[model samples]
Target: MTERESSRYIDATAADWIARLDRGPLTNEEAQALEAWLAGDPRRRGAMLRADALSLLSESAGALAPQFEPTPFAPPAAPPPPGVSRRRMLAWTGVGGLAAASLGVLAITTQPAAAITTGLGEVRLVTLDDGSTVMLNTQSGMRVRYGDTVRRVELLYGEAYFTVVPDQRRPFVVDLPGKPLRAARGTFRVRKLEGKPVDILVDQGGVWLGEAGTADAVLLRANTRLVLPDAAGTPLPVPETISTDHVSRALAWREGKIAFEGDRLDQAAAEFARYSRTRIEIRDPALAGEPVTGLFAASDPAGFGRAVASVFDAKVEQRDGAVILTR
Candidate 1:
């Protein structure tokens, strides 16, 4: 990699895509974006899956688990229509293969796995091809697997909420990399917290939970709960009335928003910084202690700054495209 290109690794926007690809197949839009990226500059595709390079934030994944090929839950479908291939004939034909070879294929495959990409402060839901879904919270990532025997999803990084459609005989399982938070066959939610404890919140038909290395399993009825990576594998407090409001608030990212209710000002600023590309600098540290409340459009940094300013009698300034919050 050239010095310039190497320097830009941390700034690559395709990091998230690479992470998702690590889990499973890309959607039509993702595939096209990746192909266009490949055609634009060959380096993109190779950089994505190559074991050598690590994401800007994750050094451990640099030694990622083996390349687990993605298999669709159903039969392999037909290939793309003929027109699409004809259009890329020139590029694929390699009239200028030698010249473009320098670009490589990494960019096409790699997706971002930055700490800010799927960490605990935000919630994101991804729709799979088969109508099932995956929800990513502030700081979590899972390796996606869908195949003939089982629809397996490995939580490679942090925490994620999964809602799988029941395939009856073919059960859905969620297992942490080195631990256990297993559940077999049902519609439910399981979150694998990195160091704290893995929590299972069963919302539908009965599901089972077992340790990472043992056969000891327990069946959990609806509205069941448990915290694991723990010794006893104790059942946590399952609120008879599960307040999705907290879940919904925690999961605001799926809607491209961040809802705060009198959360500390500093915390609010930190959350806003994640969705925003440009950095945010608070000029007055004291303001960080102030309380903030309301819904903020995550993609709208300017609007958030205005909201803060107008609500708290603060001032917003822009210096070189970065938001400077001051009071």
Candidate 2:
């Protein structure tokens, strides 16, 4: 990496570092120094704050795995002018921003807002200024901010697909605090797993993965998977035989239903509880021990109780809106 890129990495790490420090009491001098560092740049403070949140999300997502894609990973919907977007685009160049600026400055305005997000079970489709689209999945949120120098979207929360317009001049960077940002020059899928790891899958072109310190960046080619953490960033090998088939299944929740193939029964109940307003309680601890794996849609607790009952040969009773299950 060049000196400029090195500084950028440091800038990225600053957020996660400050957040780590904030957990402890700092002396007045330490606090003052921090204030100075934050004030040094227009982007410093915001970057640091985002770093903290990114760390937490990465950690949480890592804890859960297998299938892990949410909604559709679409390209930015807004079209970039006659050329490649980021190697060249950002939200500063989009519809909302384009209206205020000349067509000459369109892509500049739309770049940042390219990273979009959605709420629980809520799927969002966003058009980027470069004409690429993003389909955001449920219970997630993120910020897309493009710049003249770089196309950067801070994955504040959740995941999205980025079909870059293909510009070699500027790279598309997906920023997640505590994790090395995924710099894409082409097309790729980056998903955040709560409490576990960040999964980057490249469909076309490739991506460059780098940490916040002195480390060589890893290049992930097409049809590849790379797992990483936010705080302790690392590029892990994705076995060719172990590609993620679960990404599609995990994302099935966008339409409703979680696909589990012989997953533990208790674990299933906990997941069901998140989607169903009426909790699905397992009265027996051993019930959680039983393995359950299959395709089950998320809906009425009463209905799920029936499904669980039939599958497990267990007892299911509905009290109020909650479904109580036992083996």
Candidate 3:
């Protein structure tokens, strides 16, 4: 095969692997095959991350599998083919049954609770028995456990955007590392920061943040953001009210892009690391603190690293599967 054709074949294979992995657990043989493919070529790993096709497969894991395509997995909802509206497409694909089972519209009480996780650069949408929806970011996972009196979800790691269905009879709460955010009705985003506190952004309704039994708690209303306590159990400051614009920037990863405005280089790299295997190393501590601003594709850390290198007149090198930047 020609060089370009060979590259395209590898990319397509990586995309297919991602779709298969997203469907659920992989068999032992499948896992080994995937590892072998990734080990064959370093560039193949990048192709895998950029594919990130799980989010598209999220809606039709089993029954509707034939109807949904994962080839071009772009976010923010692409329009259906020329004559088809999204609702009609869903109806035809048989998504309603799966969605119903997820949202407790069906008798999910007899079912076992399962955790959902997304691999690097992958995004997944999960619906709970309580009718709540969670959009998990790359390298994220959560556990769902519901009971007669309470609906609880544990954010094991990473970030997720939640859309809740209010249940006055049973409060819905998300448990983070240090504390839990309880809500009777609301939509919010929660991110578990590495080596720091969990961040909560409430877009609608109300959220109560604190240790479940503690008297010292805070209320988070619409358009509010706050850092919850650290693992050390440090206290949180008063939540800050934010504008819709700020909220949009924070959640821009949902659209397959990361938006930054006057953010430090180190911070930007950390954000990018969540979506790709490409490691961004700032060899110069001084350069790490330099501020940067822009929007870049979440799956293209090499491009972002090059952009930073150009802006700062630094050097970009690839070593040991990592992108290292130096001045």
What are the models' TM-scores? 0.49, 0.55, 0.62
Global lDDT of each model? 0.50, 0.51, 0.66
Error of 2 at 7 (Å): 42
Q: Which is better, 2 or 3, measured by TM-score?
A: 3
For model 1, residues 240-260, the per-residue Cα lDDT tens digits are 334434444544443456677
- TM-score of candidate 3 against the unseen true structure: 0.62
Task: Tell me the lDDT of candidate 3.
Answer: 0.66
Give stretches of model 1 more than 4 Å off: 1-131, 135-141, 158-161, 183-242
Candidate number that wins on TM-score, 1 or 2: 2
RMSD per model, one decimal:
16.2, 17.8, 16.1
Between prediction 2 and prediction 3, which has the larger lDDT? 3
Ranking by lDDT: 3, 2, 1
